[model samples]
Target chain A: MSATAPRPNGAPPGAVAAARRYGEVVAPYLVLAAVWQLAALAFPSYLFPPLDAVLARFFAIVTSAKQFTDVLATLWRILAGLAGAFLIGGVIAFVMAQSRTMDRFLAPILTFFQGIPALSWVVFAIIWIHGIELRIFVIMVMTTLPAFTFQILGALRAISKDLFEMVLSFRPTRWGRFRVMVLPSILPDILTAWKVNLGNASRVVVVAELVGATGGIGYELLQQQQLFDMTGALAWTLQLVFFVLLVQRLLAWIETHAFRYRAASEHSL
Target chain B: MTAGPGRLEEPVVRFDRVTKLFERPGEGTFRAVDDLSLEIHAGTRVALLGKTGCGKSTMFNMIAGLLDPTEGTVTVNGRDPFREFDSFRGKLAVVFQNDRLLPWRTAIGNVEIGLEMLGLAPQERHDMAQRWLTQLGLGGHENDYPHALSGGMRQRVSIARAFATNAGLLLCDEPFSALDEITGQRLREEFVSLVREKRKTAVFITHSINEAFQIGDRIVVLKRPARIAYDVKISPDLDAAEKEAIRARILDELSA
Candidate 1:
């Protein structure tokens, strides 16, 4: 016989462990769905649409070409705004890292921007910017730019001086230094910055759409609100939710592969 | 590249009255090295032995082109290593106190760092790095990340990194100081043999008297603020008595 009793069903220990972990992750969400379904049985369809109706609407929104366009429009706005802010923030962060005067001048201004509310920027964008896409883009950038700049700045500051000096010892060219040392050092923080700003941008874009734009999830939600259709509201909201979840999973996958070199401890934070 | 043409008479490294001072926040100027002058000839192993705050690292930094001398000139290969830093791209290498391996890089990848800077072909660098790794007893560990290796093994990889570049000069700043006694001694022997075989000019900074004796043909003991206190030449033919006298002298200077 084996040293001890074999796993039930003769499954390998690793597979069993993986199955348990996945079950733990799914258990809470299952409970949440059950609770929502129970609430739907008691309340009217307008107040709390049944899960099956919500699922049907969610499928219709995904399957229908015109309806899916709104979802795609929102994603495009979010990505465009994030890409613009990330590029600008990276340049600003680099300048800040290089010069004390630039850092001192720009840091406070960014902090001040961070304090201004997202809705306030939407209002400002409505007043100042004429084009719908430009207005939404400006709002997205304003809301998320500071966080991107600050996070990247923090990462830049946190690079080990010893490691930097070691790479410099080889007398790398400026671009070589960046490709060899600076990029790898800052990448983890950059990914995390994208992860955070992606969420913030998604939320901010919807708000910008509601006020200044015509076609997006937020605009669709406006239509649902006027009609008082709970099913459409939940379904559209889930579409955005699904999109966020998909992107988040993609980011997580990248993190796993990119950071596999990291040593794991038996006890992790 | 060794010493530059017309500067053939000049040593590989010459520091003429170098003084490095730092201004700490709210503490005024703190002098780390004061009016220090030294010369290191090519193809020689010179161990710089000093106390904790005797400016060994300061001098090392100056020679490596990382720091500018405040008062005087530091010339490596007969050029200002700082002002003419880029010109020494593949001429010299440094093995620091810590291994300083790039965590994202494998052992061989870290070894290929200098070769990359030199614009060598990937296959050529890979072969050079692999040979160095294998010579350093890290043959199978070429693909292992720095975190996966032990301290001694990681230090070996760093040694491979410096040597793989085929740099004529190697500056070591207490590379084995953090290792266990046995492992440190073993690496020290391996390092000495490699240095001898390559015929590379080296300046090793350390505080240990035994290490100074083990690695250096000439040991230069330093006092506080970076002035040389004792400089002596040791011969291989010297017996135990001759070696003891030099050791005693180094001890006296260090205690003083």
Candidate 2:
């Protein structure tokens, strides 16, 4: 057949076409069901709760006002932390790019902070601010700064010396260079760093809250665990995972649409 | 002072006994430039022909003030370029072989960058940018990004950008080296017309002997550890056939 020739419905009809496609799609689920059945046969009830029990727990968490409130509180804290981190870390990264002395001075300190786990900072943050909000500040400073600095520095280094000469020849002012050259050229690296740090920040937020929060998803998980209800703890953990996945999907959408022009600009550079 | 502008018009660019050296591992020094001297008059187009690492780029860099000569002084438009970098930068534009258009900017955006550097008003910079883009036959491609354009088109944008700056000296280091023969030839013709119209003095470096013959008003050939081996001035009146003959003759002399 000619490559250009169009098929009638974009795919060939077959004996399979007469069958229900939805049932065909669920064939994989049938295999999964058989595996679950075998597991139920082999394993004890406590270790492996039936899929129905897990589904029931999922529905309960979704319908619970307290669970939803707890999740909202955690989400709010994460958003506040991310906002603060984006601004503070972005400025510091820019400063690092401009001056070698500043970069040298801060490099070791940042590396040291990044090497330590989020849990290590929780005690100090509580001592300093004595509240849940303090963890957001600590998380922003620790998780975001190092990634942001490294991303900006990496982008700066990846630029061609010849391209800089071309800029010099054009004689752009400091502002012009920033707007026309620096912002666009280093955008992809900066975005990648932001995405990486977003995940880092989210994970750290949970750790910080779980260790010390009074009223958030982590706090709820802690309370449930203290009450000896493993199902509630697992449900909260699943919710956190779902939230992270949702944010990632949202970021992907923004990158593809909202920031696409900036991405396009960087692609050529 | 009256005699031929008393070296005032003596030469727009001059290299006075310039020497450039680099150090090698377990070696004292590598002499890239050796007390080389030459004079190029205002509006003169000089082509420096040499093999790779023969110091053609180094010499050009010295003239462009990208590097200082190890020993002798170099001057452009009667000013020592190193003394005031900004002043020198104001009048000198370099076109590298890699058409380094700021990838972030559109074609006209790249062209207008010099005006922004000079602190020109936005309207005037935009107007000048538009005019130059049109002049270089890039009228339709002004808004196109560098990635969206072909190599020859990007080179054309580079040319437009270099010319738009109104620099007295244009230092081109194999600007067309990346292009195929046909595009290179067309660009050379376009370049000749553009330079003639702008009345800009230029020093072009190229490995292609034929390209030097086609675009140059004068040519300087260099051997390794370079000194100018031959200086030839072509008659401006020469037709294409005669220019081709001149190229063949110059190649034969260089090979010998």
Candidate 3:
């Protein structure tokens, strides 16, 4: 009695829709590969290596423990920098949200830090700090801290006064109130802050490594650039890109599960 | 029944010449509550009734330890609720004008908030919340979020939240004012019965005369800036004629 007839392919409607979604995800990457392959056919292999050669290098980097250590090193720097930024930013934001004087005093400083470039932080860290890991960590924290602070402060300010007062009526301990009210109230923005800062951290980590670090993906990319090996360059770049994409998908999945309480409208913004 | 909290000689809540003043941006000082002295005995329901802006909520907040009285003392259980706010950990609870359910928490989770604060074990609090939900006619809605519930159901969840803590003092600031007429009436009846059954010392804030009558045994009508204009007790044994006379007096007090 439905208006549309059954599909000729005999696939369930849900499966068909899922297939279409998967197709949408894969299409752009396929197109990019085709374009790169065409360029490889037209040019010399040094300038534009074919997709197969780039993929071969990608596997080689994945398989060789020494080469793969560079990948792991980069991953660790990105994660550690982001974690450092998030913790420092959370404290600053909490203090700022609690006191208007602190907010006024620190807001301008954070904004000023936000204006400073990642490369400048790399230089400052190299001059001011001692070690490579510490330098990259400082660069990552300085670059990403301001945005996290502002996002968390905004979330804190936007908590419902009614809900706050309701929670207060129970006379919870300071820690209890934070666990019950403050944490959940600010978690959505916290997750979003991480997602936004992840991209920034990844980019900033590479820049820091290019300047100061002797061993991360940026160092490897520098090696590729020096050798003028397009395949190696493409392979290393893909590693970072793939890492970012994987993390973004993981964050999206977390948002879905954590915020499932949100009402789903027929149309989305 | 043996009286534990109800038999205490000291007042459960006492407002000794309390006055609350809020500083407006350009209007200078706005006196929301002024020179009001009141005593709420244990196990008695008191409805502070007035027009909007009469500072009923101000008084409610004072009792709930949310606001400090600008001039005089407001004490609950013989201690200051605001200055010594943490002392009343399991002693007081509130039902606000809106449901105020945490949107991210499920119905049972919201109910378990105060229990969580009181450090009840997970299974104990879970069972307590489940029982409260069942008692409120929301037995199967323990997992529904605020957005998934209707207004009436959400308010019931809030009510369940308030009662689950088993607090001695309950402060409600027009908890039923947002619902439709029929829903409001039903909830009012249920709420009043619950309060009586639990023998809680409750301070209810409301604007409706009928709601005050339904909710409180002792009704205190307030004038502007929250001075008690007329105070009367509605005894259960009163006849219709006597009830009508008291209603007329309340009408006069409210109108005047």
The most accurate candidate by DockQ is 1
What TM-score would you give candidate 1 relative to the actual structure?
A: 0.96
Selected candidate, larger DockQ, 2 vs 3? 3
lDDT of 3 by residue, A1-61 (tens): 4758887589988998899899999999999999999999999999999999999999999
What C-alpha lDDT do the candidate models reach, one value each? 0.93, 0.78, 0.91
Better of 1 and 2 by TM-score: 1
Candidate 1 residues B1-256, lDDT tens each? 3456776566899989999999899999989998988888978999999999889999999999999999999999789999999999999999988899999999999999999999999999999999999999999999999989999999999999999999999999999999999999999999999999999999999989999999999999999989989999878998999999989888999999
lDDT of 2 at B112: 80
Higher-scoring candidate on lDDT, 1 or 3: 1
Docking class of 3: high
At residue A178, candidate 2 shows an lDDT of 76
**Tens digits of per-residue lDDT for model 3 on B1-256?**
2457757477889999999999999999999999999988989999999988889888888888889999999999889999999999888999988999999999999999999999999999999999999999998999999899999999999999999999999999899999999999999999999999999989999988889888999999998899999999988898999989988988898888
Cα lDDT tens digits, model 2, B1-256, are 1235434556878899988999898998999988899998888899999888889988887777677888988998778776656776458888889889876578888888777777779899889999988887888888887888889998988888788779988999999989988998898899988888888889999998878877788998887777888888977788889877767766775675
TM-score: model 2 vs. ground truth: 0.76
Compose the digit string of candidate 2's lDDT tens values, residues A23-134: 6867877898678667766887455556666557867877889778878888787777777766776777777778899899888887887787777777677677765677
Runs in model 3 lying further than 4 Å from the true structure: A1-3, A266-268, B1-8
All candidates: TM-score: 0.96, 0.76, 0.96
